[model samples]
Target: MTASASESGNTVAAVDLGSNSFHMVVARLQGGELRVVDRIKTMVRLGEGVDARGRLDPAVRERALEALDRFGQRLRGLPRGSVRVVGTNTLRVMRDAQGFQAAAESALGHGVEVVSGVEEARLIYLGVAHSLGDDGQRRLVVDIGGGSTELIVGEGVMPLHMDSLEMGCVRLARQCFPKGRYTPRALDRAALRVAQELEPVARRYHNAHWAQAVGASGTVRAVQAVLKGLDLSPDAITLDGLLRLRECLTRAGRESSLDLPGLDADRRPVFAGGVMVLLGVFQGLGIQRMVASDGALREGVLHDLLGRMASRDVRDQAITAMMARYHVDAEQANRVSGTARHLFGQVRRAWGLDDEAEAWLRWAAETHEIGLDIAHGSYHRHGEYLARHSDLSGFSSQDQAVLAALIRCHRRKISRKALDAVPDNRRLRVERLIPLLRLATVLHRSRLDDALPAVALRRRDDRLDLRFPAGWLEAHPLTRADLAEESTALKRLGLALRVR
Candidate 1:
């Protein structure tokens, strides 16, 4: 398909649910650049006090929802594709995230994507790199959030190496300075913890690998503010400056005593923890100097959404990469994909499907055979596993879940269990998509290059009727039998398929 950049509206919004704060950026997409018209940031500290079982404290959950309710108001009437909302470390670690996600989506009136750590790192790098443009120089990007820290090594807009460390401002603060004290001992312990987190990936990210370093997100920016605010490191972020800041913070004794000029009051409690994490990066990575970027994840999201509108989606790249990795049959996959797209166009309007659903159907058709590499027996299950677990860049956990569910139901007896993998809100439409994918694969079961006869597909409430060229099914007896069995199989999914 030809790529199209035209979208419903030029205005787009990105909401970032960071561990420490929630931020929203509304921008106008013009000539491939983002012009910010409105911005919102609220400190809800969503990462604080998350239990081991991945449950947030009730008060913290309430606080997060309240903040999202306000964000939803601003985003109330925006077109679906015009806004992108993502949750980072806090949501990622939340085991029962779907429960909270349901409430959060209700308040926001939009779906929330819980992105993987590496994906978050990629978005962070995208945000930081866009501001710098493509300098053709390798650089290190660091973003400190409330629950995790992302470090990316990249040249221009692409990230070559990325890692999301478990250490974050809010998590570390509660661990080392529960009472908000910044004593030397507590600070040393926090520093040690940060060093340990970086130990595994420090070699690839050290100063020797990058031309320059850039800091991003709230924590690093807060540190920048304090350093300049206090005249400690008026011109640059240096280890020396960090050392002096640490001294000042330690001398102050506690968060309440902190009097840094550039630090926001809301950031005070977690400031010490953020500082320690950044300081450790400076030391561990041997970063001599660093600069800050105004852009972060939300900006990256807007850029990504813009790409999606333009049909330059990075997720498509991810799908292609995955197909290549799994040794997918390009020819056969194309045959199925073309057929699926053809059928989707037939029933899209009748069934109320949209571009997103069409995209998912096409992806499922293309990669349905990814599991054949694992084993010829029940390859569908293997494909489903890989789809669910593999870190396909640009896909949220829920996105992966939906894609996996589609892959799972692409063949064999459709099961309620497989459809259950999809989130509740989307299950109904996906129920509609499953049969299309199954039918497409069934029609292409021969895996030949021969052209298929035109098939007219119509949706009538709960039943789908497919009419082929006169006597096409009689000439293709194998397909006739496959369709006969397919009809019975789809009955498990409560759908009636009629082939003529």
Candidate 2:
């Protein structure tokens, strides 16, 4: 749901559940700009908790819950939609992520969404781009996180190219320097590993020829600080300065004994790993110098939240793009969407649905036929597959799952198994929306400009009563026959559909 100005209270918050740290930023909207109000961060090191089985360790879960409890105190009493919480790489890989997400939500008192790597790169770019003053020249942004690194090239606020590599400070540190002993051999091997990961996209990023390079993330920030403290660069990170720092780090021998100026105690353990990753990036991408940005993923999420509250949501754009790409029949989509929205207005209160549900319904109605481009046979299944697995920006994993379920259930028999695939907490909500979408699609099956009759709908428990203008059904025999079949299909799912 998009929050309006009044509902937003001119206050907003964003939480980033990163692999190594959990960060929360609270900002106030004033004069059409976000002003930082408060910030909190914790070194959760969530990536360390995942075992070979992909299960989050119980101790690690407790630590995360405890940290969230602290963050929850500051977030208390904020209206829903005023705050957005997102999880990054670790949560994306966990096998039992659903159970962990539920517990985390309970502790934080807000919904948690897991985003794709590409989406993560986009948000990071947005945050970094917004932090710097506008410059017409193209810029390259790099973010080295605990479990992944994102590289984005863009001009101004719009990102043109984004790629995420699966190498990070935490993962690399654990793999090469597990005991905090950073031997030259281990550092060389780590750098070599990162180079291999970047091989596929190195040429493209180098060829983009961005006028300037910017870095965003704790790793990059620390690197800039160390260089400045040592009077190496005095400003930004240069290739020469990084080479000097790398020499110092390798000679320090162990993370515990390293006494580098401007290095934070919390950052020391991961310093070598982060430095090696940056070294690899600079070497592979042919970057000469890079400056650090004050913003990161949490800041990007806040800006995105502001956009949604102001009704300029990117999700709407993503849906429109998908529709155009699939060659959806706009007229038919509009007909179905209009009918679905009209029906939704009548029964939303009874079904306990809000604007968010309405948004999903409208998107589902518009893109329901996306799979027809592939083949007309079982197009619903094809649409479901695309929606579920595609790297759709501005949408969380949960949002995609719900969308896939709605499209899957739009035609043919509404399978119990299909509904069960939706998140447990959201199953009932999708169940309620399925019938409305089905009825709307059936009403517009002829794909003509024919106007639909005024229809009234009511809900009581699991039963639905649909009332059309008198004699309207008799005038539309095909629609009447479709409704008869729909009624029987709904009955199998224990929903009584009574039409008059």
Candidate 3:
């Protein structure tokens, strides 16, 4: 896909490969607001397909692929950046997720991003905040998926505290109610286990922090429906209402034979387990009531896409925050960014680098020195550590990996092994961009505002030829020597850099 196609689309779509269900939302941008045009959701029970060994069952893989094929049909003709697809907890935990991801991408005709749990929490908050309107009240948003539960506290659209618990409905169901029977003992065990999981973060989410509690995801929506249908709660999910629903489930005994009011047949299988998780959340966090939100990860994804299209990307804000936290030199960062952008423009077309690549490069260039905050010695490694492990909002797991790789290799010795560690499809791009970043950084090593002479860069197969104006190299002998040394480093990575 061309850069133009990615940036110039009115229609956008988001696909969430959730643990229990796969969901896709297509929205149209009109009057600066997203209008939902289509939504598709299918219960694939993706979490249930993973065994104790974390390997995805073949049958489950087939179900997931079939579902993606269907989603692919709806997503056809969407521009490259017009669509964003994310894989959640089940894919995160799968031992062989790469295999599934590759197949899924093929089925969907787009790349799939596997986001970190904290990032997932942020997206959930974004969805909930946009859906609930801008009341300016701090909210506690909880999302219970098939394999994980995300808890977030935020005001407006910014998430202040976020956490992703390892427990979820499908996981709890598999562990405690494998036989499909909802015995009191099983319910007790599930709730107790969930409570134990929430114990550490319970105090952080107590009533004092947030104005109101909100729930997003199918489990909570189903629970709210059941509560209203049973007349336990008219418009909200309350502790007492959840307890009553628990009693009814216990009375029903088995999930398959159980019939409940306002419960969809599709949700019946995981309904009991979902209730157990919500019960744990309510009891552990001391939440009296939680109102359901119509939006979730999918909506959040769309809104984030919109932000990117509108140049209000949270990622830029996140990078800025990181810079502030690390005390990065803004002037130096801007210099490096400017130099990198100039170099990128010279070779982007030849190297097939898109706007996304340029964006990553610019962000890396701006924040590559973050590790200096920790210590000057081996700061690049420190920077890489922070970039890879930190809970950076708006960045997917893959984004972190690539960004970290670039930072790790931005200075000192450039290692092919480090570049090889990046995602398979992105290795070449990282390799191409690393030299550009290194050159840019080297040019600004003096941190001076002196005007730089125009330099030309051309790529020929595995070789990069760099030509500077006459006498520029001699006038800047230090830069010349740096370029000479960089040539050797490039050779180690199987690339030839010719400086003239």
**Best-matching candidate per lDDT:** 3
Q: Pull out the clashing pairs in model 1.
A: none
Ranking by TM-score: 2, 3, 1
Give each model a TM-score: 0.95, 0.96, 0.95
Clashes of each: 0, 0, 0
Kindly report which residue stretches of model 3 are placed more than 4 angstroms away from their true locations once superposed. Answer: 1-9
The best candidate by TM-score is 2
Clashes of 1: 0
Cand. 2 TM to true fold = 0.96
Per-residue CA lDDT of model 1 for 350-425, tens digit only, reads 9889988888888888789999999989999999999999978899988888888888888887757777778898
Off by over 4 Å in 1: 1-8
Scanning candidate 3 in windows of ten residues, the lowest lDDT window is 1-10
- Whole-model lDDT, model 3: 0.90
